[model samples]
Target chain A: MPIHYPNGRRFHETNTKKRSPAPKKISYSNRGMTLEEDLNETNRYYLEHGLAVIHKKPTPVQIVSVDYPKRSAAVIKEAYFKQASTTDFNGVYQGKYIDFEAKETKNKTSFPLSNFHDHQVVHMQKVIEQNGISFVILRFTQTEEIYLLDSRFLISYYQNMDTTRKSIRKSDIEKNGHLIKMGFHPRVDYLKIVDSVYFSN
Target chain B: MPIHYPNGRRFHETNTKKRSPAPKKISYSNRGMTLEEDLNETNRYYLEHGLAVIHKKPTPVQIVSVDYPKRSAAVIKEAYFKQASTTDFNGVYQGKYIDFEAKETKNKTSFPLSNFHDHQVVHMQKVIEQNGISFVILRFTQTEEIYLLDSRFLISYYQNMDTTRKSIRKSDIEKNGHLIKMGFHPRVDYLKIVDSVYFSN
Candidate 1:
């Protein structure tokens, strides 16, 4: 026997008598989706819930040419992706300006500093100087763990790179960063961590 | 005699002896550039002076198809411009979230409400509800005058459109909006106006 989905994909049916009585909880972290997709979904949830107004900036592209065919919409025919000058996410949250860059790594032991660009470092520093909350969300895909690392600590490491190691180890993150617990609706409920870390004072 | 520019474009030179003794002041407003270009220049000035950290979000595009030719960059062979979910300019300034949309109208008497979309109105409303600063920068290109109209007033007019007019008259803007004095360094010194209007007690 086979169970067919609405889109017509059939799954081989298993014997009911030999199966365990209890059903197992589904784990979303193993779904093989990118971290970006998860963050987008989480942002959408936050927006609908009136928790935050954050949004990911669109991908920058250098449009070189466009074709306007007769009785049709104009089409971008030739373009190249451009390097972004700012971080991906920014918005207002609880009367404070929030800006952050999200990155995921398969490497379990450390998060490479090379994941960030020099301009992004400068931008984050500027944001901090202006008293806005700036941080990076680091997702360790292997462990399904997320950490919020403040820009002050990130800048210290960036400036002293000549004397220190090139990457921030998992131990350093575990000590300085705040871990974000996974959620059912808003998969990454980062604002909860923001409240405790930034507003606790 | 003709005066030639550095790039070799000849400007018809009226007799040097007949011209005024003192050099005439250059008018930047008559430079024939778009409002977007002026705002970009102003934003650059603000960033350089550490006055603000504002940027225009990149235009959203839906990339439908791409072709990777041999030995060269990937070509975006087919794509369409997507409607932006948020306003154009957004950033943090003086610890407050700043968000705005810029528009220029050739008509000197009024600004057509049709320049805005329903979603933009909703987004601005959300920004206001969260206690963030939100507004519109309306430039009358014919008069070379700029005005900052707060979202609260704009929303009032938008909601009462059935009984009200289709556009905001210049007289109404003159009475309700803050006029931004044009300057040389930052052509539109809008943040100064923001300070006076939003932060002034």
Candidate 2:
């Protein structure tokens, strides 16, 4: 796959079109912290700056037993997921509701739709019908590259997985997604994209 | 504590409220489940009908340990809540972002703000600032009367706690809240209130 760059150059995942090497290595020894920790820290920065209001939807759980050991608290003795969620995080930004699913891809060539579940696809469909901005945040774990792909592109590709190409190529993602630049305060400044979409009219 | 109808009749808890009569038989017999069970059943009905999308917020827990038996699901080992949440159920209805806290009060006289947490109050304030509609679903556990009290009212009363009132009086709630007629399905049809607020032109 290829994407037309501003200089009229066709960029490909092959050796001919490699993205510039990542700027630098992060100093923090985040050996065990999952990508979720870094993103949450970044989201906190965005919230403090009034940039966006996003929250990781809590994993839905069905509690079978709760023990009230004391009056002050109730301990969940047993629980399980009642239903799968549509996305990891969602919130309102610039008067428009925003929803998204985030996935980490280890593949070097492309991201597989197998990372997503059917219920998530259905949930995104409902969000789009309700006029909410919906998308998928794909992180290439090895390269640490993150891109926001609109749901329109995602669902289309997801549905055509069987007969179509193996996965979405790097070149195609660069064309459709707004690349999220990693930063110091908030690693992923996603609200900037939300501002560009909803407020920059 | 009272609400007057247009016919100049007063509606008080004593007359309109009906206690879910305690099982006359022994606990060893088929005593059935708690009020929580009935409400859970009702929420299931609502979800099946697409009337609303509300879910019980999972209890925040601190996980310390887990045992991974081969070929079995990963069990939570140990965990604790990082912090308390403000409300119980939050979701979308008729394009209106709705957030709410639910509490069960055995006190037939009134519901107490002590049932709410400081963190929850702060969360509600933030939710309102972000253009989301928020309220509390108060269940008179014995009487089964559920009232939807706007967060605005709750916030005002909360702030005035040190000065004038310590609790939101039952009379004030009756005056402002929209009474939900309990049913078997969708136990609490809160979308009816959302429709009135967001869709009534």
Worst 10 residues of 1 chain A by lDDT: A9-18
Per-residue lDDT over B12-36 for candidate 2, one digit per residue giving the tens place of the 0 to 100 score = 1121111223322222211222334
> Highest DockQ, which number?
1
lDDT against the true structure, each candidate? 0.77, 0.62
True contacts kept of 1: 0.57
Q: What is the interface RMSD of candidate 1, in Å?
A: 13.7
Task: Provide the TM-score for each candidate, comma-separated.
Answer: 0.85, 0.75
Model 2 stretches with alpha carbons more than 4 Å out: A1-33, A60-83, A163-166, A198-201, B1-52, B80-83, B163-165
Q: How many pairs collide in each candidate, listed in order?
A: 0, 16
Docking class of 2: incorrect
lDDT per residue (tens digit) for residues A137-177 in model 2: 88887778888888988888888787567588888888988
Best by lDDT: 1
Model 2 chain B weakest lDDT span, ten residues long: B10-19
